[model samples]
Target chain A: MLFDKFKPMAEFQAELAARDVVPFGAVTEEIISATEGVVSGRRVILAGTNNYLGLSFDARCISAAQEAAGKWGTGTTGSRLANGSFEEHQALERELAAFYGVGHAISFTTGYAATMGMTATLAGPGEVILLDADSHASIYAGVQLSGAEIIRFRHSDPEDLAKRLRRLGDRAENTLIIVEGIYSMLGDVAPLREIAAVKREYGGCLLVDEAHSMGVLGDHGRGAAEAAGVEQDVDFIAGTFSKSLGATGGYCVSQHPELETIRYCIRSYIFTASSSPSVVASTRRALQILQEEPGLRQRLWENATRLYEGLQGLGLPVGPSPSPVVAVVLEDRSQAINCWNALMSAGIYVNLVVPPASPSTNFLLRNSVSAAHSTAQIDTMIAAYAGLLEDGLIRAR
Target chain B: MTQYQQYLEFMLSALEARAGAGVTLSETTRLVADIGLSSLEVMEFVEKIEDHFDISIPLNILPDINTLGDLARKLQEVDS
Candidate 1:
């Protein structure tokens, strides 16, 4: 009787199925997948997963993980403030600092938790949070929870941000400006140089979420800030290990030693259990491999360009700009579902983003190419989209 | 100008902008009837007001803002 109020799940599933956007998850995207269960009957050219650097399957990373598990016994059993701080965890923190050329770094359990902890520490009730309108949800929630007055600027428009800050006048000094490296849904990057300039002029701290661009951008893959050459300009650089590092955790790295003071105040860091030693070990190893190898990053960019231009050539209304993520825009919700189902039917699985997820704009098929993906896989993906375009499933002006 | 009259002008304009482009609105224009504030549209209007004035409009102020005059008067009072 207590469980009888679960009516929404059925309606949701029914509505989604009727529209045809069934969000399915799978294991991996090798020419031949190693796991069964999900992709058993699917041909899966796997383009939705955020494994940009393709280090999850790296032999060195797997070996490091196995060794760490043997040494640390699988779990940390406490928070970093308590008994969770292992020698490996401290080493990973140091490695992360050196990797980013910053003096301090603290790792969290997930990307969302990193943002939540970092933001909650930056602004208080009297302070203001000026965010880009299209920032990630974690950032939005973090500001909301911190009791900050969130003033959002137009997406990627620094002029709008300047106008908003001017409205705040003297109160702007207490403001924190937040932006992202590469937006997840549409796959567009922020105009960081202009944003950093404005934040500095306003005497505010800037936080850049490098979640989607780590291990994929920059000459050293130090994330998008490095790619933009504005590392020193930003106050807090928040990033996730889950996407490119092939682990589930987040880190807030900065040169400010006082940034470490947030360790005591951030609820997400204080409460959550520290990431497993195996995770840290793997990320460290992944970083080493990322630095040691440059060709992998090149292949990733090559694939991204191929898919993006291919979609454009097919005239399928790809996203406005070029990045690793290529989105096929279909404005109608049902059309997005149909296109998603069409991809799944072709044995190609990608993310089908709809209204709310797509910045209150249109529906889209969001895809990400990996460094591990070969030309053959890219060609197959392009050919499938070419078919869709020829059939007029995705229309263009 | 008197706060009442200033409030009247603001409401008339806000109602015209929010409800429709060419609607003739007066001081006593009911947000629910004349302007027709669906829950979503009401919140969007509240956002515009907050953004314009650079103030935090408490969520509680929403239910009481039933008319154009009421909204403008509330803004004046909050500003003061």
Candidate 2:
């Protein structure tokens, strides 16, 4: 009876196994490049990975990581509070603060820890948190643990956020508003300008999670806030090095002096071991590369546009706007699974998302483009999708 | 009718529309088990309730709520 709750999931896994469709956690046998990998015994174009800038396999980054590993060993054996605060960690923090033009920055072992810790610690009991309904699970977990009054406005609807704030009235000043720069599922972006304007009117601190948008957006790669020219309105920014920096870590940067004090109070930061020296070194190198090479961002955008246009030309239902992430929407679960399997068979790998993981009840075949994808590679993916349409596996929207 | 009764009446009507008119609703009726509302549908229903009552229901309270009576009681607490 203790395991009764897992029965449904077990049945679902069994069904998927019977169908020979392993959508989730398909192992990568060998990483050929930033944009190519041998997955499930087949060499496939890696489209589902969130490696936006494609710096994972850069020789410079690899060299930095190797050098750090040789100098500092493989891992930090203690938490930051204990003995894990290597000079590299502090240096990376300072660099992150400088990059964001913020007064303070704190790094975490994982993006989930950063977002969750910030969300949980920012507001407390009796205070309110107005978050987008489509927030990531990390944020939701943080809010549930925070003991704060968690109110979810409709996803990306500034009007709904305004309405909720209006109801709060005097309590609005104590509220924390949270939104992501680029939503993960559909690859849709938040209207940061409008949301920031609403925050200005409501008098609440705004936190923007730039996990997917950092190093992909803005002239300086400061994410949606910089792109929207509303950086001043944003109070805190949480992001991950895993996506763009091609490393494993997360950080929160803020102009507020209190952030330094708040760092001591975050259990996620205090209890967990800090990032290893190699990860920090590689992340620092990646950040430098991101700043020095603006052409990478341009190429990323161009690849995104090519994929978006190619999918649109095929009449596939894609996201609202063209970003590095392009997801094709489907209503039927079986059809979505078949299409995902078909793409995998065709040497193209993408993410198969079904509800309630998806933003809505619909299924999504999510593709993430990278700067490393050559024009020919992009066309190959498009051709494969076109084949799916011709086979009637997926219908044109 | 008291405000709580009015709220219950509205909820009953809404459930009847979704779960069929023949089904019965009471304070003990479980929203998910009895009415078969999916997670999304529950949120939509909560939004509808918030709009009708002109109140913002904190999602933090949902885990503690299961039966219709629990929701009505929680609504009353927040409404006040």
Candidate 2 docks with a DockQ of 0.91
Q: Considering only N, C-alpha and C atoms within 3 Å, which residue pairs clash in candidate 1?
A: none
- Scored by lDDT, model 1 comes in at 0.79
The ten-residue window of minimal lDDT in model 1 chain A covers A29-38
Candidate 2 residue lDDT tens string, A51-71: 999999999999999999999
True contacts kept of 1: 0.00
Q: Which residue pairs show collisions in model 2?
A: none
The weakest ten consecutive residues by lDDT in model 2 chain A span A12-21
Which residues of candidate 2, in runs, are more than 4 Å off? none
Give the interface RMSD of each candidate: 5.0, 0.6
Local accuracy of candidate 1 as per-residue lDDT tens digits, A1-397: 7766567557766877676455744433344531111343566777887778888777789899999999998999999889988998889889988988889999898999999778767898878888887888888778878777666677899987888788778988998999999888888888888888888787788999999988878899877888888888988899998888877899999989997787788999889789898998999998888888888789889989998988788777877877788888777866677777777777677887865567755887899888877788878888888777677776765
Give the Cα error of residue A239 in candidate 2, in Å.
0.4
Position A222, candidate 1: lDDT: 78
